[model samples]
Target: MDLIIIAQAVGLFTVTNIDDIVVLALFFAQGAGERGTTAKIVAGQYLGFTAILAATLAATFGAGFLPEAVRAYFGLLPLLLGLRAAWKMWRGDDDDDAPGSNNGPALLTVATVTFANGGDNIGIYVPVFITVDHTGLAVYTAVFLLLVGVLCAVGRFLATRAPIARALSRWGHVLLPAVLIVLGIVILIEGGAFAL
Candidate 1:
């Protein structure tokens, strides 16, 4: 259990940040305006996360999957996705739908964004699971879910403040993708795909 908690904490902490903020923005823009909406979104996020983690664990233990080269390739996924998002933002494309807008805050939307945003995390966890015990995977998943909910609540509270939210929204667009790129690079280096 302790191992699980540690893995969950590490994985959750690794991915929880501006990336999540962008995802949350999608939900908020979609009209998740009710007071209870954030909680529901968080719950939905966890469901998606758990599903991904389960799959990752299965692949790790059952198939001995995720070779180092494969991990490096997966590490680049976030870089590509983040760069695409940044390009869209730079091009002033606002046509992207918020999660709650079309589906009315359905669990599916939450799952979608969770899976999407969790792509890099999944890549990271592949290696983690290769080394860590299966129980650690569960702990990592639970802790990540708990922390994400808290972070979303806090972010919602902050975004409700007009000026701060606007400032965060502006900077978040620029910073989030940059951070993801850096994380991808780091992972690649760790996987020995990059020299420095």
Candidate 2:
């Protein structure tokens, strides 16, 4: 059980969420310079993550169960999402922050972006969630909920760090997309979604 808890935590919180640090940091940095914006970003993070989890659970265990054959292909979601991010970066569309500049997008807007960016998360979460027993599932859910706050706080702190934040906002476009594409490949292989 302990090992399962750790594995589940790593898989759900860290391994599958590398891209999130970038996105979350971006969200925080987007509002870090503005007063009261950090709270909004944190709230949006929780709200968006909850929605993603709810939807994944429903698809994994709902009336119409998710299929593994299809699950393997879920990897494509992240792989392509990464490519898209990279493309946007190449196109100079990435909203890079200069140390502490942020428009502080609306809380709702932040949530929407979070949800939208979670396409990869949903793809990986479904199979992982379904494989666990109820107890394990509960553990994963609880840990995820708790870690989310920590993740947000870390992101906010990083945003306040000018040098690091600038680098992340600048090079994140390269590193994050590469990581996501690799993650997608891993999920595809590990989930046996491409066994065919």
Candidate 3:
């Protein structure tokens, strides 16, 4: 491992995922005190990041020709999810959709949000992925996954704190759906996914 290149990759990945720390914390807070909460959030993070790596690898390699329109359409996953959450909330049906509930955004919803959030990551990771050869990419991916675990641990720790956990517990329901909706719309517009 060239120390300098590894350092650069670490720096770039950390900078790109800075927001994820907060996002992950919020997710942890969502299921705070619930059994297996941390596990679910970590699983979702891994799932989402895997999708990102796949997309980056695909784009960096010969499979880089996906149309912008089609890419934007990817926003649909998160958008529909957010809408469903809002609908459930509005209908007072959120009991079944609560964080620990079967209908709530679980591993897959979190993965969608992570993937949708990672649209910009492709732009960043593609160049990095291309610049690095197979070996370097593999090493970077390994480090990235390890760092993701660390990130989730930190997020879970912070979420377990009394103050933050309470606030998130009170407001997470009101905020999560709205956040997902706006996040999806931003992804759509940013990616130029709209037909217009």
Give the poorly placed runs of model 2, Cα more than 4 Å off. 65-103, 165-196
Q: Write the per-residue lDDT of candidate 1 for residues 1-196, one digit (tens) a residue.
A: 6965675576556554456665565454343345556666777777777766765776777665454455555447556655665676677665333221322244654665465455456566677667766566666666766776776676566666777556644565565456556655765666677743
Candidate 3 lDDT over residue span 13-81, tens digit each: 788887777677777777766676677778888999999888888888869555446667667776777
RMSD of 3: 2.4
lDDT against the true structure, per candidate, is 0.58, 0.66, 0.75
Of candidate 1, the 10-residue stretch with the lowest lDDT total is: 95-104
State the local distance difference test value for candidate 3. Answer: 0.75
Best by lDDT: 3
- The top-ranked prediction according to TM-score is 3
lDDT per residue as tens, model 2, 20-77 = 6766676555454568777777787888789877878887786454444655565675
TM-score of 3: 0.87
Relative to the unseen true structure, what is the Cα RMSD of model 1?
5.8
Angstrom error at residue 180, model 2: 14
RMSD to truth, every model:
5.8, 5.9, 2.4
By TM-score, the candidates rank as: 3, 2, 1
